[model samples]
Target: MGKRFENKVVVITGAGGVLCNAFAAAFAEEGAKVALLDINEEAVMQNARMLTEKGCTAKGYKADVLDQESLKQTRERVNADLGTCDILINGAGGNNKRATTDNEFHDFDLPEDTKTFFDLDKSGFEFVFNLNFLGTVIPTQVFAADMMGKKGANIINISSMNAFTPLTKIPAYSGAKAAVSNLTQWLAVYFSKTGIRCNAIAPGFLVSNQNRALLFDADGKPTARTEKILRNTPMGRFGEADELLGGLFFLADEQQSSFVNGVILPIDGGFSAYSGV
Candidate 1:
């Protein structure tokens, strides 16, 4: 592979999971010094070790995106180990089961066993909202400081298709991701003069541990929910984690996307565009 990011320092939050782990490897493969940040120390450390074994410049740091002080410590560690960051990927976010509805649609009259909109827990909703929204904001607040006034510095956010269209049963995630997309635009304008660009990637359904329960049956076959998703998606398949790498690498590359800003690039296999007509 070519050294597009030779000597460039990339920081990725939520690097413990499948998506961000792939991101860490991809950036490192392109000759960038990648710092993997995650609240899960064991997983992040394992990923960092794996990348190092592959001869990629990488290190893992424990960081909670929700805590500013924790991020400060992480920033210090990253700066010391990998130099000031050139790219920041805010990827730490997930849905809470407590915040998700049990059923896809609400009925006029519901049973107590069912988690309808009326019975949704306020604390659960708040946790989900804060995890996805504040998760991005806090990390940006801490990590973006390193890129201030630095030429070609960029920020890439992780949004979802649900941000554009509220999917059934995940109202909190949909709303929080929408906030991320909106904040991306606001920050782009706010930092226009700093030569720093901000953009987001709204990914389609990817088969990962997060949603595997809903998508796969006991025998490792596709569930009814998976069929529905594929039917709505024009491409008739789920995207792979590595599929997101190209869009991410393009947005990270200043030449390809220097003029691009505040755009929510969708890599959803046309799932966001299909009208279900």
Candidate 2:
């Protein structure tokens, strides 16, 4: 409605998911031509169609963030469809159950079937790491080419609370997101002279479709982990997907965030501030 991004092309990875879909709609509402990139071809295309029905300039493409070649191809298609990307949001990443320990603590008497730290699979760690870290790196590599020297170019990476501190049960995701935060700072400095600003959003506990299983039990009651999370979070509630738009829009807008770079903004409702004391 503000038209802050009028005529600008915005690219969002994981565009089919709960959080990223909200991002896509928000950008489109702000008058940006949005390119929704996701590994789920059908879902992404469906989202694209819905946006089209709303008269928003939007399209969807199949992309695997870990696949550099696929990203390059996506860039080409997006350029041809919606023009060059001025804003890039790397939102494709998730924690796999395999990469998560079965229990939060170590005990010798734990069930043999439980996946403890010692029983963690290298492949699982590799999968989660590649999905979160390389996912952001490869897309930036492919798309940042168009952003160089371009006015109002901004790149926003998605980080998690685990990036600031290791979260229990998901070591691989924690490490990978930490890498993402580190890489975000590196890119901001590397592209400082190119007129491109890179930053990240480290979100706290939010109930998205991706992590719903872990947050809720089979009977739909909040799990013990969810209770712990809410107790630790000062806000005592999970963030809604739309709540991220303010920070995102601010960072993406040149007038608003021209001097803001290399910083990881936490929209966590003060979850990071709590010391559990």
| lDDT on C-alpha atoms for all candidate structures | 0.92, 0.93
Model 1 ranges off by over 4 Å: 109-112
Among all windows of 10 consecutive residues in model 2, the one with the lowest summed lDDT is 111-120
User: In candidate 2, what are the lDDT values of residues 1-105, reduced to their tens digit?
Assistant: 467899999999999897898899999988999999999999999999999999999999999998898889889999998899999999999988878888998
For candidate 1, report its TM-score. Answer: 0.97
Evaluate model 2: give its lDDT. Answer: 0.93
Per-prediction TM-score to the true structure, in the order listed = 0.97, 0.98
Off by over 4 Å in 2: none
Instruction: Count backbone overlaps in model 1.
Output: 0
lDDT of 1 at 96: 82
lDDT of 1 at 7: 86
